[model samples]
Target: MANLNLTQNGNFSSLAPIIPAAGDDNGRSTLIFLGTGCSSAVPNAMCLIQPSDPPCAVCSQSLFVPPEKNPNYRCNTSLLIDYCQSDANRSYILIDVGKTFREQVLRWFTLYKIPRVDSIVLTHEHADAVLGLDDIRAVQPFSPSNDIDPTPIYLTEFAMESLAVKFPYLVQKKLKEGQEVRRVAQLEWKIIEGNHEKSFVASGLKFVPLPVIHGEDYICLGFLFGEKCRVAYISDVSRFPASIEYVISKDGVGQVDLLILDTLYKTGSHNVHLCLPQTLEALKRIRPKQALLIGMTHQFDHHKDNEFLAEWSKREGIQVQLAHDGLRVPIDL
Candidate 1:
C-alpha cells in the first residue's frame, strides 16, 4: 500500500471499501495484503465441490472472477509493508515471495504504481513461502534508483541453506569462466538468528523476529515491527513461544497496534497451522487494537467468514476481522 488514496478499482474495491486518508505530514506506513490464502490457495485444484457442498458457492464464484476483482480469489500468502520515508521516496519491504509473487507484483504495479521493492524478509523456507524468488528479476528493472546493488533478503541460516540448494544460481556470487553472464535476480543474504531480544534494522525500520513452533521440527518466525505504529505479523504458526508472549505483553496486558495472525480453518488443530480456537486464544493473548486473520483455506467462504468474525468481534469487543487479498491498513510511523 502507498500513501496515495486507493480509489475503487476492479473487484478489490468491493472487498475493502474503506480506504484510509493519505498525505499526512508525519511519516506513514501501510501494510498491504498481497495474498491471504494458504498453501493450496482458494478454490484448490483438488477441491471441485458442487453447489451442494459447504464451500462450493464461494469457491465456484471465486473461480469465475479474476483475482483483481475479488479479494476472496487468493493466491499464496504474502504481505507488502510500504513505508513512506518522504514525499519523494517510498520504500517497500515484502514478506514472503510465494508462487504468486509475479502475479502479485504485477497487480500492485497496476493498482498502486509501485516502482520497486526495497527488500524482502522470509518467515521460513516452505515451498509456498519462497518458491517465487526467481520472479524478482522481473522487479529488478523497476528499481527506483536503478543501482546495481543486489536487493537484500533477510532470513535465518537454515532458510538461506534451503534457498542455496533450491536456487543455486540466484545465491551464487561468481560466474564460472567461459560462462556467459545472463540476466537473473541478484540478492544479498542477511542471516537472522531469530533472537527475540535482538532487534535489527533494515530499510529504516526496526524488526524483532519471534521464533515459534511451526510443527514438530520446523521453527517459524513471527515478526514484530517496532516503530511509531507497532505491528506483529505471524502468518504461519502452530504455537507461540513463551518468550514471544512476554515480548508482546506490556506490564501485564498484551500490547500491539495491529496483529496479523494465522488461522488455517474455523476449528480443529492442524499439524503445522493454527485453528480458529487457537487463533482466538492468541488474539486474547496479543490483545492488539486491531487484528486480522490470514492463511485461510478453501473451507472459508469470504462472506461467511467475515460475517461470523464481525459478530464475534462485536460480542468479544475486539476489532478482529478476516483479511482478504488486496486489503490495506495504514499506520502513522
Candidate 2:
C-alpha cells in the first residue's frame, strides 16, 4: 500500500520521493522549458496583434505595462524533453504545445541552435496546446541547409481522438492520396499488471501515465519520468488520485523531485484546474523538493505572484518558481 492518503477533496502526498537508480542504460535526459505562460502567454497583448477590426480588451490592458519591464513578453507554457538523438528517438517530447509553440520553437531554435525536431507528446488537445501543429510542419524537413523530413506525434488515445476531430488533416492518414505522411503514435493506457503501473518505454525513458480528472472526464494523464526523478505534470487536471503514489514511489524510494502543475484559479472554485489551496494541499502530500506553477493566465501578475509564492513555498519547505519562456532545467542522469 502507498503511504500517501487522498483527502475527500482528492489530494495525496507523503515523503519526498527519491530519484530511483537508473538502469544500465547510458543515455541522459534533458528538459528544456519552452514556454511557461498560459494559453494567452506573457505580454498577453500579443494575442491581440492578430488582424481584427477591434483589438481585444485584454491585449490592450496588457500593452500598458512598461516596455522596459517586458520587451518581448509572451506566453510560456510548453516544454521539450529530449532524451536521445536519433531519428526514431522522438527527440522532442513536448508537454503542451500552446498557441505560442511557433514562436517558442523559433525562439528555441535561435537560442538552443536546434537542428531538427522529431516528435511531440501532447498533454491535452486544447486550442492553446494543439494550434501549433501547423507551425511544427514549417520546420520539419527541419534542416535549414537541407530538408530533414516530417515528424511524428505521440498522444494519448483521448488526446488523439480530440485532435483528429479538431484537425482531421493533421492525423488523417487515409484522408486523401499523398496525405498519409503525417505520423501519429496512439497511446493506450496499459493496465498495470502485478508490480507494474501502466508504463511505456519511449525514447529510452520510462513514461508512467497516471490518471487525472478533467472535469467529468477522467481522460487526462499526468506523467512520471525516470525511476526516481519523477515529475507529475497535471496542467489541466482538477483532482489527484492516490494511485499517483504508485508512480511517484520509485522502487521503495520516496517522492518526485519536482511537480510542474497548474494553478488556474486564484481563490474561487474550479472544476477544471486546481486552485491555490488545492495545489498546496497536493504539494504537502507529494513533498517534492520543488514545485513550479505553470499555465498561468493574464489575471495573475508574474512578479507579484512569484514573490508571494516564493515566501509561501519557503514556509512550506518547498522551493517555488513561476515558470517562464526559455527556462531550461537539465537533470544529471
lDDT, residue 185, candidate 1: 83
Per-residue CA lDDT of model 2 for 1-333, tens digit only, reads 123221222122322233212222245455666766666665565456672466544345455863223413546467777665433343656666677777776666666666656556566678877787766666564343322434555566667667767776555434465543443322222122112265765445666666677686655667767554667666777886556654554322466777788776557658777777787777777777766677666556555666787677767777665655555454432
Q: Write the per-residue lDDT of candidate 1 for residues 115-138, one digit (tens) a residue.
A: 788899999999889999999888
Name the Cα RMSD for model 2. Answer: 9.0
CA lDDT of every candidate: 0.77, 0.59
User: RMSD of each candidate?
Assistant: 4.6, 9.0
Q: All candidates' TM-scores?
A: 0.88, 0.72
TM-score of 2: 0.72
Maximum-TM-score candidate: 1
lDDT of residue 326 for candidate 2: 58
